[model samples]
Structure formats: structure tokens, C-alpha cells
Target chain A: GESVGLHLPTLSVQEGDNSIINCAYSNSASDYFIWYKQESGKGPQFIIDIRSNMDKRQGQRVTVLLNKTVKHLSLQIAATQPGDSAVYFCAENKATDKLIFGTGTRLQVFP
Target chain B: SQTIHQWPATLVQPVGSPLSLECTVEGTSNPNLYWYRQAAGRGLQLLFYSIGIDQISSEVPQNLSASRPQDRQFILSSKKLLLSDSGFYLCAWSPILWGLRINTEAFFGHGTRLTVV
Candidate 1:
């Protein structure tokens, strides 16, 4: 069975520091990947996405790196802020357009 | 320019009561709809997905069911709610690309918190 999972359950970071979240997926056929941020009592919000064709993609203050050989995915957040505190999840887009999500890593930013 | 809307930000129902959560998409047509549940400290569990009206796919076998009566309307229902069904329900939508049913990115609604007491 194919599954996506996170490397850490929780992460703590100081303000202005960089944060890295890791994810590993088992489905080699997956073509697209996305990162979502979910705040308390809210639905997961789309942050950024990268296709399998590209190794890396950059957004406003975020970046997503995909390693096809290792079947690994990572999200990097620059200048962590209090507002950035939330749970981050990595998802893989299957051929059917169904996204399989990881357990998620809670990102805590301390001021 | 598309948005998803889900109602009843919070809910509390008896264990045996019935449940119905509604989700609709605007600014798009013929989008793919999905239902997902998130338990405390867990990941998103996909429940059901629909590519078109009356066409649905169930990812998990449970007490829950979903329907797509209209192109942009999706509903999650259950005849008898269970304690295990209490969780955060999220509705998402994605545009279908031409010639293929694949979607680029999914957009989610605010979500509904259902607590079966």
C-alpha cells in the first residue's frame, strides 16, 4: 500500500529562524506534491506545490524540495514567525487527483 | 478565483443521531470534490470523492456516505453517527484539466468540527 508520512510530529523554532519539515512517500507513480498549513480549528490551507518533474519550487517565504530517487519531500520556511505556527502536512497527488496526506508536523514558533 | 464553502462551523450531536454536512464550490464548474476527516493528532483521512454529479468514489468503508447532486454541490451524510465519527470534516475542490480527470491543486473550505457526544 502507498502511504505518505512525516519525519517528526512536532517542531519548535525561534523567531526569524528557518524551519524544515520532512516527509517520505511510498508511491513512485505520484506526479505532484503539495504542502498545506492547518491552523487550530481550521481546514488545511494550500501553501505550495511541486511537480515530480521539478526537484525544487519556491513560493513567497516557502520552498518545497522533492527527491524522486529517495521518495522524499521537504518544506522549508524562512524567517519563522508567530503567525507561521501551525501544523504542516505534505501530500501526494495520485493519478486520480486524490491527495494522500502525511500525519503532519506541528510547527511552533517562539518569540 | 474559486472558493469552497462548508457550513456549521461547530456541531454536537448524540451518538445515534443523523448527520449531514454540506459543501459547495463557487466560481468553478465541474470541479472534483472530496471529503476528508481529521482526528485529533492524526492525518487527513479521505472519505469520499466525486468527479461529477452522481459519480462518487469511496476511499474508506465506514458509517459515512457522500453525494454530489449538482456539479458544484457535495454532501456528507450518515444515518447514525458514531463516537468514532467525531472529528474535523473538511471539504475540498479542484479544477479538472482538459482531456484528463487530474487536478492541479485542491482548495479547501474552512471545515466543520463535529463532536458526537
Candidate 2:
């Protein structure tokens, strides 16, 4: 079965530092990938996205790098803040426009 | 300018009770709407999706059903709620723009926290 998963289940970083989260996907046909942030009690918020044709994309303090060769994806956050603590999800959209999301990585930033 | 609205923000219903959660989009017409369920300690599972009015496609078979009555309104309903239905339900939509492309961006509304007691 085609699936997307994270390399770490949880990640902790100190405020003002940097955070890196990794994901690996199995579907080669999945042309679109997105990273979302979900706070404790809200829906997932769109962070950044990358198309299969592109290897990298950046937004604000975050950067998304796609390694199609290894089927790997990563999200890097600079100057991590307390507000950055949340569950992060990586989703892959297949040709049908259906998104398959990873289990999620819980990012805990300490002040 | 597109906004997705899903409510009630939270719900507590007993098992066997009927369920209805509504999601309406303002600023986008005939968008592709989707319903997803996030169970405790689990990932987001796609339940149903609709591309247009009265059109629906179910990916998972459960006690849930979805409907698109208008171009911008999508609804998820069930004859009876189950304990397994207690989870986070999110409504999302993609712009009804060009042809099918995996790179299309989708946005979500404040999810509905469902708790079946």
C-alpha cells in the first residue's frame, strides 16, 4: 500500500534554535506534497507545499526539501518559538487529488 | 479570499444518536470538498469527498455519509453515531480551478471535535 510516514514520532527543540522533521513517502505518482501544523485543539494549518517537479520550496521561517530519489521529505523551521510546538503532518496528493497524510510528528519547543 | 466554515466546533453525542456536521465555503464556488477523520493516536483518514453538487465519493465504509447540496455546502451525516466516530473531523476544500493536478492547494476549516459518549 502507498503510505507516507515520519522518521520521528516526536521532536523537541529549544526556543530560538532550529527544528528539522523528516518524512518518507512510498508513492512515486504522488506529485504534490504539503506540510501542515496542527495545534492542540485546531485543524491542521497549511505551512508549505512542494510539487514533484520541484525539489525545494520556502515560506517564512520554514523550508521544505524533497529528495525524490530516496522518497524523503523534510521540513526545517528556523528560530523555533514556543508557539511552534504542535503536531506536524506531511501529506502526499496522488493524481486523483486525494491526500494521504502521515501519522504526524509532535514538535515540542521549550522556552 | 476563500474561507471554509465547519461547525459546531465541538460535539458530544451518545452512541446510536444521529449525527450531522455541516461545512460551507464562502468565496469559492463549486470547490472540491472533503471529510477526514483523525482518530485518537491515528493519522488523518479520508472518509468522503465531493467534486460538485449532489456528487459524493466514499473512501471508507462506516456509519457515515456525506452530501453536497449546493455548490459550496458539504454535509456529513450518519443515521447513528458510534464510539469509533469519536475523533477530530476536519473539512477541507480545493479551488475549483484548472484540471486535475496533484499540486493543487487545499485549505481546512476549524475542525469539529466529536465525542461519542
Candidate 3:
């Protein structure tokens, strides 16, 4: 079965440092990718999204990069903060309108 | 300005018990509704979606089913629940972006935590 996976189960970063989370997906037909932030015992929150037509998308303080050739997706946070600490998940939306999610990487920002 | 609501924030039910989780979307019309599940320390799994009223699509074959009785009301139900069905259920709605396909972002509710013993 086609699915998505993250490179790390957990990532620790300094409060003032930048953070990058990596994700790999096996579904080549996927055209849309999204990054979500989930806090403790809460539903996932939308962070940013990128389409196949473009390789990069930027939001307020977050950026999403897509490498179609490698089927890789990444989310970058500038000056990571304590509030940025959460479980990050990369989701791929196939042509069928179904989203398959990656395991997730827990981002821990040290104060 | 859209909001998604999922109710019975937490539940404790025994195996083989019937289950029903409600999700309602407000401030949006004809939005795409979705149901997702997340196990302990796992990722969000897509369970069902509805593009319109009375339209439902199931992604996995399981003891669960979905219904869209109204335009923005989606329901997840199970005739008999299993122990493995215990998890967090989330409902989301993707607003119409430019009146095109599903190219917009999704708004998620707080979520329903189910514990099936």
C-alpha cells in the first residue's frame, strides 16, 4: 500500500534556531501536499500546503518545499519557538481526493 | 470564517457497542467534509469524505460508516464497535477555494477521543 513516512520520530531545536522536518511519500501520483501541526490531545492544524505545479510555498512564518523527483516534502520554521513544538505531519493528496498521512515528527523547541 | 465541531469530546464504550460521532460545519456552504482517525502516537488517517449532500465516500473497509444527511452535517457511525476502533476521531471541512476543486485548506475540529474497552 502506498503511504507517507517521516525521517525522524522526534526533533529537538533551540528556541532561536530554525527547524526543518523531512517527509517522504511513496505515492507518485499525488498532486498536493500539506503540513499539519498537532498539539497534545488535539486535532491536527493546517500549517502550509504546496501543489505539484510549484516546488515551494511560503506562509506567514513557515515554508513548504516539494521535490517531485525525490517524492520528498519538507516544512521549515523560522526562529523556532516554544509554541512551535508539536507533532508535524506531512500529508499527500492523491488524485482520488484522498489524503494519506505520514507517521509524524515531534518537534521539541528547547527554551 | 468557518468552524468545524465534533462532539462528545471523550467517550468510553465497550466492545460491540453502537457508536455515533457528530460533525457539523458552520459558515460554509457545500464544503467538503472529511472524517479522520488517529491512534495513540500515530498519524491522522482518512476515513471518509463527502463532497455534497447525501454523498459519502469510504477510504477503508471497516466496521465504520459515514452519512451526510445535510449539506454541512456529516456523521460517523458503527453498528458494532471493535476494540481496535478506539482512537481520536476528527472532522474537517475544506472551504471552496475559487469555486474549483479541492484545492483549499482544511479546518479541523477539536476531535472526539473514543476508548473502546
DockQ of predictions, in order shown: 0.75, 0.68, 0.67
Interface RMSD of candidate 3, in Å, is: 1.5
CA displacement after TM-score superposition, residue A111 of candidate 1 (Å): 1.3
lDDT of 2 at A7: 88
Cα RMSD for candidates in order: 1.0, 1.4, 1.4
lDDT of 3 at A26: 94
Give the candidates in order of lDDT, highest first: 1, 3, 2
Candidate 2 chain A, poorest ten consecutive residues by summed lDDT: A92-101
Better-scoring candidate (TM-score), 1 or 2 = 1
Candidate 2's interface RMSD, please? 1.5
Tens digits of per-residue lDDT for model 2, B1-117: 888999999999999999999999999677889999998766788899888899899997899999998999999999999998899999999875665433576798899999999
The lDDT values for all models are: 0.92, 0.90, 0.91
Residue by residue across B1-117, what tens digits does model 1's lDDT show?
Answer: 778889989999999999999999999889989999999878999899888999999998899999998999999999999999999999999897785776487889999999999
Interface RMSD over true interface Cα atoms for each candidate: 1.2, 1.5, 1.5
lDDT: which is higher, 1 or 2? Answer: 1
Quote the chain B TM-score of every prediction.
Answer: 0.96, 0.94, 0.96
* Per-residue accuracy of model 2 over A1-111 as CA lDDT, tens digit each: 788999899999999999999999998878899999988788888899999989999999999999999999999999999999999999998868677799999999998
Candidate 3 CA-lDDT value: 0.91
Full ranking by DockQ: 1, 2, 3
**TM agreement with the true structure for every prediction:** 0.97, 0.95, 0.94
Top-TM-score candidate index:
1
Which parts of model 2 are misplaced by more than 4 Å? B99-102
List runs of model 3 lying over 4 Å from the truth.
Answer: none
